[model samples]
Target: MGDIERALQTFHSMRVSAIMPPIFSMPIVAEDSPIVDVLKLLKTRHHVWVVNNKDEMRLEGLIRYMDVMNVLLPPEHTKARLGNISSLFKSILGGAEKASDVMERNVLVIEEDATVLDALKKMKRYKVQILAIVDENGRLVGEVSLRMLIDEFLRLMKLGGAQWTQHGSSSRSESH
Candidate 1:
């Protein structure tokens, strides 16, 4: 490919390997683990992966901090009528539930070798904020979010001297 094509190609197909940290390093829990465990983990972590195998961490799905809140908090009307009392009850009761009961299944995932564009496309299609990264074995290896992707993109654009921003635009208009 030409120099321009190669440079542009980086924008379209930057591999996740360049950005993702090792996945196995993240927190994981058994699917049947009590929700209380997840809540405790989330105190210091954004989310935890749920695994099916107790002996081995085989990812089944993921439980986000927001998902736990969704379970503990009542709907808008319910909240208005029941006030904080009902939600307080749920906070105590919800802890008894298992991870599988709350974790989001069929989570969108991208292979480690896939491009950032591929990951972005899947996230958009699934309407999800985060995506699990998997290996050829389809085992959870890492996680990526739209925030990370965009930040990395912006960093690259700035480094490339593309001058696509307000300053660049003003300069272009002045030159014309």
Candidate 2:
């Protein structure tokens, strides 16, 4: 079988827990945090941080690279724009915002026990590059990237078309 075939097979046979990359780290900020602060965090982080009210690590949403880029783009340059400086000031102040204001809340998520195929399907369906791995309790555990999946798929192909095996099963854990 080929890499895609093997990956598909693995997705059918194993759970996401088996092949997910070990959690490196995740940056987080409160839901009502100032956009400036979130921007600062994004500047020195891997992925967008997530947070809820009370400054808790709820992983309620994500701010991807594109999200930041969208924010950085001048409003006049895009169809989505604030009508006046007052609106822009409100956006910068974070007072006129909600967690849903700047977050990709409708994110694709998969369980740790879900098959790799599940992740792949979700990615394809959503046309996204990343999937948030959540546990049974609905807590964010880690993220799975398309790059990680491709690497694993390549490794499987190198196994001389052998049955897919998990490279590692360690859970990528994170804390607030």
Candidate 3:
């Protein structure tokens, strides 16, 4: 079969487990963690998983970078000092001052056994960059990201495109 056809077959068969990032290293924080502290943790990352507490590690929700961006500083204040950031959000956020206060409770997820097609649908429906992967028991095991999926897809396409460009036709067989 041709490279593009084979690529489609491969993509359709890809499971979440095939591309999900390892779960052990994901950044996590307590639901009650202070907003300032969470912001500090998220400064270099786009998201953080919030657990019920430091001990239990029960998944509560996710604190997206966007939430921090919305609560803490206006877009124009990207260069604002840390000291001023807290006060800026403090008044606007009212008495809810913790991660749980702003976390996205309805985090979209896909079963670990789900296919790439399943993940793409969920991502599109939720308009999220990543989809949390869960086991049958609904425990977070890992995560699948849009970047990972797209990168893999592009890698396959590039292979096909390069071959076609050099050969002036597909490197695939006649029956393809």
TM-score per prediction, in order, is: 0.69, 0.65, 0.72
**Error at 146, model 3, angstroms:** 0.6
- Per-residue CA lDDT of model 1 for 58-109, tens digit only, reads 5698878865665665433224234434333334344437777777776777
Please tell me which predicted candidate would have the highest TM-score against the true structure.
Answer: 3
Cand. 1 TM to true fold: 0.69
Per residue, candidate 2 scores C-alpha lDDT tens digits across 1-176 of 44546455765666777776564455656677767767777777656646564323456887765566545555444344556343232232333444345666666788888876788888899898888887776667777778878777767655534443475322223346
Model 3, 1-176: lDDT tens digits are: 77766776788689988888776677677888887778887889888887787655567788777766557544344444766443344322444578887677778878889999889888888788887887776667778888889888767767565245465445643334
Where does candidate 1 stray beyond 4 Å?
A: 1-8, 53-56, 73-96, 167-176
Candidate order by decreasing lDDT = 3, 1, 2
> lDDT score, residue 72, model 1?
64
On the 0 to 100 scale, the lDDT of residue 39 in model 1 is: 89
**Which structure is stronger by TM-score: 2 or 3?**
3
* lDDT of candidate 1 at residue 80, scale 0 to 100: 25
Model 3's alpha-carbon lDDT is 0.73
Sum up the clashes in candidate 2: 2
Residue 115 displacement (Å), model 3: 0.9
